[model samples]
Target: MPKLDLGLPSYDSLFSTEEERQESKLEKIVSIPIDKISDFKNHPFHVTMDEDMLKLIDSIKENGILIPALVRPKDDGTYEMISGHRRKFAMSHIGLKEMTVIVRELDDDQATILMVDSNIQRENIYPSERGYAYKMRLEAMKHQGKTIDDFENDIPVEYNKTTSAQVGRKPETADVLGNQLGVSRNQIRRFIRLTYLIEPLQEMVDGRHESEIKIAFNPAVELSFLTTDEQYDLADAIVANDRTPSLAQCQEFKRLSHDGELTTEFIQETLEKEKPNQKEKLSFKMSEIDQYFPKDFTPNRKKDLIIHLLENWARKKSREQER
Candidate 1:
């Protein structure tokens, strides 16, 4: 038999063979029954869907779920969901035993990597979710009997360029975390730090009031010296209303709570500040300022008023500058 040579490029250089392109297209399109889905607590995408879960349940009652969820096949002949936990919970609410899911086969590491990738792209991931997810992945790797520190150090130094600034000296935890997640060492440390937060405050952290949370964090740490009720009060003060309580207010809350100086009257007063009369604040506007002037005020009178205001403002400004 004669071997014939065809003048063709190597198979590796081909961007996509006809069959490969077809398979890619098919993979892009999927619809599965929702029933086969099960949540993987170990999945990196496992964010607490408590608030959304309730809302999803209500929505399913009116409008059926419009989006399919993602899942991976388990060796036990079940499917583990990589995402769409809220949809899964809502389906359960509607008494549907199964749900539509697109399936992929992934090992523990691959599943976690995919899970985090799917979730972080969402517009509204809570801080708690981000912090929690990062921590979970860190612990998961640790549980695999692999030291994260070694894994991180083995990764090329070039890979650390973006995230190394945030990370300080690599704790063993930091090494594993940074290496596995391909994140900066600093980011890994920050996420791990959040685990120190108590549950109620952690809930607030997940609520994504970052500015409020940032402001509340130190105060909360200090206020944690007080009992649970006091912490709740501090959170209420920070979250419910926009009042930037003086440092004195926080210290006083701490001192009184500790010294047994806290009383119903004191608590009531603090809460009163938190619940300032919103209605009263909204009652007046620029239009109301018009009422203070005459109904048909002359332009000359307006000019006169402006001159008088300028004179008063200049005096105030001069006094401030002198001081």
Candidate 2:
């Protein structure tokens, strides 16, 4: 018996001409004029003409771009770069007029996820790059109603059930993103917080400015809470005093700022004081050393044990040196 044709057509057949369906099925990769590609809007990663770029240029000269860049078409007859800012940059530097790209039709959020995953795993990503990239991708994931489960293939799957077990509740957006990026929850929080920093202070965090000392990462995060004018005041004081605030000093600054007690003169006075590195004492956070101790050990007991072990190790090292 013939099956009754339900007066219904397949959605594809109903919506499209045969040519449009065929075009959708065709291969997406194509060579296009380099000028037709635009850099990703608000791209976070930097493409410096440094040793890395020189190395990349050399690699392309020898083998060509082994991987096609990913791009998305725009209404303006141009393409927005998604995953190959560095490659595009290298080809441009090499004076190549046309390049290979795989054109993907993705919305903003999906494109952001693809773009971030492409660059975040590179060996040389700076803190600022990771900061902004993680922020962008995390927001994109949340916007798309995604979770850590959706990101398995984009990153190495390292979600160990026994070791990485969460307590109390389901993971939040930042926690999900941190796991995807292999960043710890607390550390990822700090990195995302860096996006709130002003441009000059952010550059100081990157430690690339010739005129100023590199602000320590924790101290910089502490400073991100200050009002804009307060931050400028702090920056001027840092330059005038030839010193960056220590983490402790920045913590104090944060406290004062919250209490409406911070001022330009006070900031100068703080940075002008002796830096924490000049002090004789060394400090360690519990998180850094907790793995070496048993769960029941108290802080004082741990400190005593550490000192005893260090003394024995030093004496043994001295005897080895004499021998």
Candidate 3:
């Protein structure tokens, strides 16, 4: 009897295909020279050598970079890093000449969206970073033809079906952006306002300098409305007085700016105004001085006694100076 020849399929024939081979080649990681990779333009996120960064560096040194950074090729033949700025910095600090990167083709809007989304997941993000990132991503989304109605289903039917003139009157972008960021729409708007601040004022808003007074988010947002020259003048006043504006003071600054009367002197005087919290207070733990006072004595009695003793001590000092 003649046996029919039935050839078993080879492993290569079953598993290997042209499309699979192309995909495998695309997924391959390559080491690019560190010098060839440039930082993303106007990267809102900052890479600091803080304790967390030091730990990251140590981990990279002990076990080489486990994940490759994402980068896009530029027309100038250099790669622009989309994510992993800190990883790249750590590798460079570890004396690495080349770093592993996965190169992909991405347009400007796509790259901006990816960059902002990736960095927003970090544990610590400054107000300025969040502001610029949200702004960039919002712009990118708009550029990609995503309208506020796409992400927000809560829009009224009437509003959705409105004419172009009516649609232009809606400010639903903030609501859509806020939904993605897990914040109120107003909060998203406030953060986006920080992007208008100049670099110096923005750094102060970030609280990067220990010696400089840190501006709170609300006041910083208000300050962002100032013109470029006014912001510079306010920065100078902040440094000169070593003080930041309170929310109320910032409102005054904004009002003056709107009236075209905001000057360095106005900024200085507004910042110098004493806030309620700035008032001096004598603080003491109750346990520290409780033994000196009777158990039944009320707080008011204790305060009165302390005041009396201070008055007598002042009198004694005055007498000594006269003698």
By lDDT, who's the top model here?
Answer: 2
C-alpha lDDT of residue 105 in model 2: 85
TM-score, candidate number 2? 0.74
Predicted candidate 2, C-alpha RMSD: 13.8
Candidate 3 per-residue C-alpha lDDT over 1-323 given as tens digits, one digit per residue, 9 for 90 to 100: 99766897667876777658667446446899999999999899889899999999999989999989999888888899998899999999989999899988789999998999889878889899998888888888888887642321113333345442334355576667667768776566678788888988888988985556688988898888788999998888788777787898888888888889888877777767767776677898878888999999988999899999999999999999999
List, in order, the clash count of every candidate structure: 14, 0, 0
- The lDDT of each candidate is 0.60, 0.84, 0.82
Better of 1 and 3 by TM-score: 3
- Model 1 ranges with Cα > 4 A deviation: 1-32, 42-68, 86-100, 143-146, 149-184, 208-323
lDDT by residue (1-323, candidate 1, tens digit) is 98677978657757567667556434232555556566766543434456766777888778876777777766666777887776877776678866656666567866775677667656676555666577666655676675654321213243357554433443576665556657766555445444444555665555545544443443443344566666566656555554444446657876787788765556546745743322345344546467657868865686688689989999999999998
Give the runs in model 3 whose Cα sits over 4 Å from its true position. 1-25, 148-171, 280-323
* Candidate 2: stretches off by over 4 Å: 1-18, 21-27, 146-169, 276-323
TM-score of each: 0.46, 0.74, 0.73
> Which rank order by TM-score, best down to worst?
2, 3, 1
